[model samples]
Target chain A: MNATPEQVVELLRQTNFSTLDWAIVVVYLCVSLVIGVWVKQYATDMAAYIGAGRSVGVWLGVATMTGTELGLVTVMYSAQIGFTGGFAAFHIAVIAGLVTFVVGATGFVVAPLRALGVLTIPEFYERRFDRKTRVVGGVLLSVAGVLNMGLFLKMGSIFIVGVTGLSPDSGALTVVMTVLLLLVLAYTVMGGMISVIITDYIQFVLLSFGLLLTVGVAIWRLGWENIFQVVAAEKGAAGFDPLQGEGEFGPEYVLWMLVVGLIGCAVWPTTVARALAMESTQAVRRQFMWSSISFTARFLIPNFFGICAFVFFSTHSTEMRELFLSPLPGGASSAFTPSLYAMPVFLGHLLPTGVLGIVAAAMIAAFMSTHDSYLLCWSSVITQDIIAPLAKSEMTDQRRIFITRLLIVAIGGFLLFWGLFYPLEGDTIWSYMAITGAVYFTGAIPVLVGGLYWKQASTAGAFSALLMGFTALVGLEPVRQTLAKTLAPVMGDSETIAAALSAERCGLAALLLTCVMFVAMSLLFPDTRPDARQRD
Target chain B: MSVWIMIWKVVFVIALSAFAVLAVGATIGGARDVVTLLNKLKQDRSNTKSDQ
Candidate 1:
């Protein structure tokens, strides 16, 4: 009684997506392209190209920040969390919002960084520590950032394929990923941050409304009271309480989330890029304060959709139950995991044709907005932080912009390749993203905090902390598996060891280790020059 | 568990409401900001050309 892939496709095809939806999606894509290309006139200099001339206002800043952070990949992963973890997943959203609010109010890391007026975080390293630290920090940031977004194209393509009821075997994932990448590269390379900002504003409007509308429809379809009842019956106490260790999340995971939440707003490059792009440090603070709402909604809304998807699947048919709920026979797996497809498939069935198209377009907007920002971000870091600094001669603005454009295309090509070949075998997409990001932030936290606040933070401390971040790479599933096997003789069981070295635990350990390394190294090798440390 | 459920429900509602206000406010305010940004960029380009 195992369902075949064909049978699963047939069940998925019972969606409300239609020709109208396709047309809507196409029109939206065309508009985004035009706006992105049209903004090229404004990108005449390095600052304009990469930082939108540092002229962004508070509201636009908020919109673009939300647009970038609340990406389609974010939606996919958060929904998966909601579907599997139920109400417990809400804790992550709560933590993200609260942490973001605190950062905004306290002006902890972002405001000071904004006050420094550097284009990238690594640039600050050169100013405070040394040129070598900047190059090392830049390299690590680019590597971790590029790796962090490796799965984005795959997740976005999955959402498109699942929502449109396309056959998983129809080669649609590759097609969608390629087209999306090309489109994002085309505009991002041309208009840079100006293009990113304009499109992000539109996307913010569309995605916010689309999310609210879809949630309203889903609540209507599955009665709110009944939705809770189903979760209670299916998942029990663990569904409601995140602190209940019976669920996917526990105390350790919550602590890790608090750290991740802080990094999401304060330390993450793309977000901090928005802060840097603002008209003033005050604007950066206000933008983050206002963006706290979107931060919460980004996770809370998608997670609700996931819970709804779970309810829909549980009640619908025996076929769905076999596909999604039941354990696979003999540990066989599908080309795509069923849990990842749950929210899009649920929306496919719940929304009517016209609404489905608008929502689909909005989701595509979300995908593109994030892609453009990230592509622009990593490429700029490579140019300004890595290549330009290391160059024997000063680079002209035109040459810098040209190189950045070339790098955007190159990065897009890498994304396509990585998306196709890399197996998404981790427990949750969220955990995978967090751990990948931890490889950068675990080290960055100590360096950024110590450098900004502590006068004693030496160049040696910064280098040691940045180098220590590489230890988090072992948290990746494939690496963890390899490690577990190597230690199996000593540890008794590979599976047990693998499970013991969970992504959250490893990430927490890396953060703690990096912090200690930073402090110890700074004390051991204090800078001799009194003027080395810059004061605010 | 019930308390947890209630807490989530409240948080969800507040988040939704706040986001709704933000969407509308940012949309209107962002439109004006976009115009300001473009004009500023234009001015900067003119200044650069004059200097050159």
Candidate 2:
């Protein structure tokens, strides 16, 4: 008889986590909170609060950038990719590294933006186009950014629950999510970017060493050669070749990854916020170039762990294989989904008590570093780009900071509610993130690149491009499913139609269409007057 | 093994090694940067007070 979902959960709960591990995690959390609160006095001005006084150096910039981007959510989703896609998933890491390196070497969008010395990306929109463009861009960016991170708290909580071997049905997930959010909000609202930068640096150090240690232990335990052998046996050429039509990813996915990679380093607001914080444009370039190593390793290391988890489960026992690989005992109605839990559960079993505690702390560090930066980034954008510009009276720096802190709390509340209620049923965490993120980046790529590079990028063109980004929302799983169901009678099969409207295809089409619209609109109805603030 | 698998193995090793080096370098260098940043903030605060 097939093992029930309850049995699987019971089996998963058997882990090496101990009281010693809990002490280590608690101590680390205390130190991070202390450091964050200690830095509150430094945030006496808007620049210090939001951009760390624009005093960041190259190595620090690289470290903070990695800390923010190599988030727990990134690890969970990348590992899930590896579990499902095998070696084919490594292509995404390679593309990410190369694209980041090129962006650094060329200083494409970052260099010019740094030279302008704007606090946010939408601030640049105002300088190049008009105040209206800035406000609209800010609104779009905040919406997409918040939606993109909607699953982060839940994903982090899932990691904590799995690694600690807590029973998922015992309300542990909700408790963990609430505690992590409260901790992050306490530090972030207190210290703003100053605390964020300091904490990110520390987290970067711990996460790097922790990752290497885990990978080393995994390789030693599983035997490197055996990993390849099993993957080759089970998945065939499709596992190794991303371009294989039967593989998890194909030509279109590879192309889409390239765009995603570019946007990740160059156009993403949180990453660009690092650039804005740097001491010089030269530092920004160097930071990205050096950060390419981290950008690649973040994905590559987690992916290897996922692959290891697959090997472990496959070789461990018959029941293990069935639990992870086979359809649910009762089919799609079953409550358990195994992919996201695989890596954490494997770690909980593999690592010893003390070492497991340290790694867990490091992962929590990753979680907090990402949350603080994101909360600060979005809240500041709303204050500086959206609200400040719209306010009739000139707002004081103190007023702006107060509003930002309040918004941070508001956004945190929304994340808690969304994480609890949102259905993560039909899509992978990574795909959900990409589709939501595309709602901003698809439009941003055109508006940012055009406004910076092309002389004729008008306010109207920018507006049209920014509005066109909403079309990428069709790639969301629920929306796509609804469209597919509604059209099934007329268009043959719902599943086939949904598959045809894949996230990559939709995102790429939206990107191309937005670019064309931007250019056409600019050429057709050029700005009547060249603004004095427009860059050459 | 197929060429694709071999390529990934090589790539993974290189990426991991490079990241290890970056981690060490960033740790030491980032410490000094943190000090420099704090000092700069202190100076900026003093300047603001004097202006007032």
- Which candidate number has the best DockQ? 1
Superposition error at A283 for model 2 (Å): 0.5
Error of 1 at A496 (Å): 1.0
- For model 2 chain A, give the 10-residue run with minimal summed lDDT: A327-336
**For residues A1-536, what per-residue lDDT tens digits would candidate 1 score against the true structure?**
78776687798788999999999999999999999999899899999999999999999999999999999999999999999999899999999999999999999899999988899999999888989999999999999999999999999999999999998777988999999898888899999999999999999999989998998999999998898899999999899888887798999999999999999999999999999999998998999999999999999999999999999999998888777777656444356588998999999999999999999999999999999999999999999999999999999999999999999999999999998998876658888899889989999999999999998999999999999999998888998999999999987899999999999899999999999999999999998765243443
Candidate 1 differs from the real structure by a C-alpha RMSD in angstroms, to one decimal, of 1.3
lDDT scores in order: 0.92, 0.92
A302 Cα displacement, candidate 2 (Å): 0.8
Off by over 4 Å in 1: A329-333, A531-536
User: Clash pairs of candidate 2?
Assistant: none
Reference-based TM-score of each model: 0.98, 0.98
Q: Is the docking of candidate 2 incorrect, acceptable, medium or high quality?
A: high
What shift in Å separates residue A434 of candidate 2 from its native position after superposition? 0.7
